[model samples]
Target: MDITLKSTLPGHQNPVFCVEKGYYADTFFTAGNDKGVVEWDIEHNAFKRILCAVSSSVYALRLIIGTPILAIALREGKLLFVDVEEQKLIASLQLGIKAIFALAHMSWKNELLAVGEAGTLHVIDLSTYQSIYEKRISTTTIRAIAIDEGLGRIALGDKDGQVYLLDSTDFHVITDLKLHNMPTTSLAFIHNKLLSGGRDAQLVISNPNQLHDNFSFVPHLFTVYGIYPHPEAPIFATVSRDKSLKFWSSDDFALLKNISREKMQDGHHLSVNAGAWSQNGQYFFSVSDDKLVKIWEIKKIDKLVANS
Candidate 1:
């Protein structure tokens, strides 16, 4: 399969940190140093409209399933619940004085999870919109969080390159391991194994079931910011400060392809921070420091057959 750039949409004035697909899949939302959360209709290739503009950089954007509400995380330690359909703010809360870098919904428990420089993992009950749990996981910034419902595990990565594994039910620490010399930049869970990458430019694979067989590799030239699996395919993608997007075989961890201006005619001029896959696994959308959102697709190559 060959990856090709479909379109480059420009509007943000600064680096775009996060990109998330809307409930409809064809629509996606993005925000960053520009401080504006703008939704885009990928099917029509048009801007849906700006959802909200906060006073600080929007570092994370997550959409609540089956609703028009969006969870917006800002660098000023504020979490704004915005009604995207109405373009109005529904509710807001100050998470802390330090910036919030991550926010995600724990669907199984009906909770909204957020963490950042404050070093506390905040869990809010979605039904009550009340803080249900708070735990200090680290003294430094928590850069990434990943949940595995099947394994009942929660993984938190901090700026100190330490990965904290906890029980999803009680939020009790299971194990803590130092994986890199620099900050742990991203985290993802596949088949109950924790996959973590860092500013040290390394990717480490650790399995709770098999504690002694962990492995590591250098996957990028610079910091790896995001690692996400395809919605339906057995493949995953990663974005980096190295200014490229790469695909990998999920089963074997083999490099599939790399997209970059140096390697491909169409690539980001600046660091590519994040990427999201279409719900059907047909396309991808990525945001970068260059202030652009790019749409990409994987094209199948047809080979000619000869009859003897």
Candidate 2:
């Protein structure tokens, strides 16, 4: 597959911690050490508005589908519910845990899930905006969480190099496997398999039903911060502290492309923290410690295909 740089946007003054794909067309939100949550109008290439600015670093942001509400997780264990359209804070809560590094909207249960430094996971009801449940998955810091809404499964990765698979409905542990020897930084479900990456600099694929069915690769030179699957295609993207983002086929774990200024001139100069893929699979947005958000698209495929 061929890719091209479409746009490089500068907004956040500090490292952008996260970029989330909003429900609205051509809209997404970004936040980080800048302590500000800014929404962007991707189609128009302009800033839409600030959701909220906090005293602490905003580590994660998740948009509630079919609603204007956004859940913001902070570095100091605080959670904020913001009305995105009105650009105002709706409610706030102190999680009393630690820095929250991951957030997921569990629509099926009308709850928001957050995990972080304390090794605790908090489930907040969207309707009541209250913590209904909290559980400790490990003694180590939890760095990533992924939910498979259709299958009712939740995956959690921690600093101890463990991956916990649980049933979202009851939060029952299905399997707790040591997939990495170091901190597990990213988790996702792609093509019916659980994909995990870590500071071990390894990406591992495993089937939930069969422990024997697994695949692993040392794809990067440093910590892997994020891994995002394509909306429709059999591919995914991973960002690392090695200062690069790579595309891979989910089916066979094959590397398709490496994206970086070292490989291509238009890539990020620092470590890429996270990335979000558009709903249509036409474009990708990546944020980095360089304080830049880049938009990438598949460079005209027809001509390349014809020539081949």
Candidate 3:
């Protein structure tokens, strides 16, 4: 599979922490260490507008399903709900002394979850915009979070290399597994399996009932910074500190492709930080520390299937 560069959007002054595609619109949102959230129009390749002002660096941003409300997490432990259409603040929840690192939405339960630097997880109801559940794990900083909306489960990873699975309805700890020898940097879920990548340069896949010794690990050469599942394919993409992005088959974890900016003539000069697959599954987008965003289109075959 060949990746074709479509366009580059340049304006961010800091490294992008997260990028999320809109549910029903041809738009995407980005948050970063710059303490700002910027929306973009993918069709026109232009910036839409800045959503809200943040007190500290924005680490994560997620748009709730069936609403214009966007949830944002700050390094200062504050979660803000902003009205994207009206460009106004809907609600702000202060997590008191715990710095938030990741945020995700559990659409099945109509709830939002935020993980903090102190390993505290707070679950909030979108309808009432209230904190319904909160708990603290024994780990250090919580670095990443993923929600299995269909199963009504939440998975959280911390800097101390632990991953915990919780029942979304009652916020009870269902299972706990250690994922890495070092801090876990990212977590994702595709199908019935949970995927985690970390500072130890390892990626592991496991089920909820598995013990730490039972999970299988995939070896890599560099610290994994990001892991995202392809929208419609049985494949996943990972970014590493080694300056390359890897595509792996979900079925057997086979290596499909490796992408680096140096291999592409117009590649950015800094490390790749975040990536997301386009809604239609025809394209993929990635950003780097160089403050550049690039879009890659999947090549078409004679049969017209979009695969790499």
Residue 214's lDDT within candidate 2 is: 78
- lDDT, residue 78, model 1: 88
lDDT of candidate 3 vs native?
A: 0.77
- Per-residue lDDT of 1-308 in model 3, one digit per residue for the tens? 56677778888898876777765467778778775788888888888777767878787778787888889888878889988888899998888766788888877778888887887888798999989887887558888888777777778888888888888778788888777889888888876788889888888887744434345565456778788887667778888776677778877888877777556666656677777777676667777777777776666522233443
- Model 2 regions lying over 4 Å from their true place: 210-212, 299-308
> Each candidate: how many clashes?
0, 0, 0
Per-residue error at 74 for model 3, in Å? 0.6
- Which pairs of residues collide in model 2? none
TM-score of each prediction:
0.94, 0.94, 0.90
Query: Which ranges in model 1 have alpha carbons more than 4 Å from their true place?
Result: 209-212, 300-308
Per-residue lDDT over 125-193 for candidate 1, one digit per residue giving the tens place of the 0 to 100 score? 877666778999999999899888888788899999998888888888888888878999899987667
Model 3 scores worst on lDDT over the 10 consecutive residues at 299-308
Best by lDDT: 2
Give per-residue CA lDDT, model 2, range 40-94, as digits (tens).
8778777887767887998888888779898889998999998877777899999
Superior candidate under lDDT, 1 versus 3 = 1
Q: Report the error of model 2 at residue 131, Å.
A: 0.7
